[model samples]
Target: MATTRVVLITGTSSGIGLAAAVAAARAGHHVVATMRDTGRADALRAAAAEAGVAERVEVARLDVTDTASVTECLDAVLARHGRLDAVVNNAGAGYVGTVEQDGLDPVRATMEVNFFGVVDVTRAALPHLRASGGRVITVTSVGGVVGQPFNEAYCAAKFAVEGFMESLAPVAASVGVHVGVVEPGAVASEFIGNQGIDLPALLDAAGPYAPALKAYVDRTLAAFGQAQTPQEAAEPIVEALTAEHPPFRVQTSDRARAFVGTKLADLDGSVVQHLTGSWVA
Candidate 1:
């Protein structure tokens, strides 16, 4: 029988976080499923009830952007569970716009939730995780490796996370703590819709980049049509949490693997630039 570990996951109000929380509970782990607003956790609650894991899943409020909230949530989980086992850093935000259009504030905002959020949560959990020899799994994106057109800010954040995790994994392993990242491709979820991007407005404001932006949108949407579901995307996360020796990185789908592979195979950045440039041109 698998040991019942205590797991904390962020952004459980919807999408991948919610799915991973429910799935982790179903696997006999005590799950602390957190969202920025617990008031919006109806869907997560319903899903837990349906999965018959309601008793094992506890919902908490954790706004990763706030350092205090990150500490508070981690402290609460430790107080309740007596020990921390694993943390899934799944909370993230997306931004879509050319570098010039995004400006500094939006770029910083993207980094706050997607990159710094992970850093804060991981830092808060590290001591406990070290004590338990636990795991740290973060949900990054395929864009982390391959910069997509008009997704500069989002990709930059994810790229930062991937680099951070890759560097931390070895140091973490030395302390008997495991760290890894799950990179998912275009998953069919509210992630895109929740980015708060006003597509029509953005297009109207794009000016010189309008045509390329439209093409990127069309291509991205078409790819999303064949993307994995939230549940499917959560599988790799679960595996990362439970596997005896989880991989340092796991791409959730073959498409994600292929997307990331392109960058990995490129030696002088010429091929990647050619391909990515085509998206905007």
Candidate 2:
């Protein structure tokens, strides 16, 4: 029998985080599922029990935005498991607003939760991960590559996270810790419905943008229908976390790969168009 790996996953209260925790437990990994509120983690515990992997999973409180929580959780995990195999920084939220209309406050708030929050958790887990030669898997998005319309704030945050993770990849590898990023396209997670639209108030208070902002936001929201389920997009996350040698970036779902391909093509076209009068059609 194979030895069970110890994995600490954030944002396990619901959606992709929840699904990933369940899947990890089923795969014989001892999963530490961390959510902001333990009271809301009943579903996670229930799911683990239903999968008959309850004993392999533990629900804990870990608010990514809180540095103390990250430290506490990592310490608890190390104290209990003695070895850390992987850390999944999956806690994040999407923001719906244009760059100008939302103002810097909204963008900063988004960064605090999505980018800095991941940093906090990863840094806390690094010691344990390095000791065990473990892996760090960050759940980024397709928006991290190309700027999305309505979610410019969210996109900016994800873009920063992508940059940070890319830069840390070699650093982690040097310490025998592998860093992997899962760029999921539009996963049908509860993120959209749970997103805070109240940022518009801050935008109003900060000032306003041109009428074009509304058009941009509307165009972006229309793309939400293309999202796949969290389960579908997370399969690669599980695979990457467990693989002996994982790729730096794993594009989850067909839409994720398609989005990346389109972005590459667009970049190439722009370069060709700049050099020649005719567009690369």
Alpha-carbon local distance difference test for all models: 0.91, 0.81
Q: How many steric clashes between backbone atoms does each model show?
A: 0, 0
Candidate 1's C-alpha runs over 4 A off are: 1-3
Please write out the lDDT profile of model 2 over residues 86-195, one tens digit for every residue: 99999998876555544688788899999999999988889888888899999998878876545668888899999999999999999999998999876777786777
* Model 2 per-residue lDDT at 149: 48
TM-score of each: 0.97, 0.87
Cα RMSD of all models vs. native, in order, equals 1.6, 4.5
lDDT of 1 by residue, 1-281 (tens): 13569999999998999999999999889999999999999999999999999998999999999999998988887777788999999999988897787579989999999999999999999999999999999999998898888888999999999999999999999999999999999999999999877889989999999999998988888988998999999999998888998889899999889878989999899989998887767
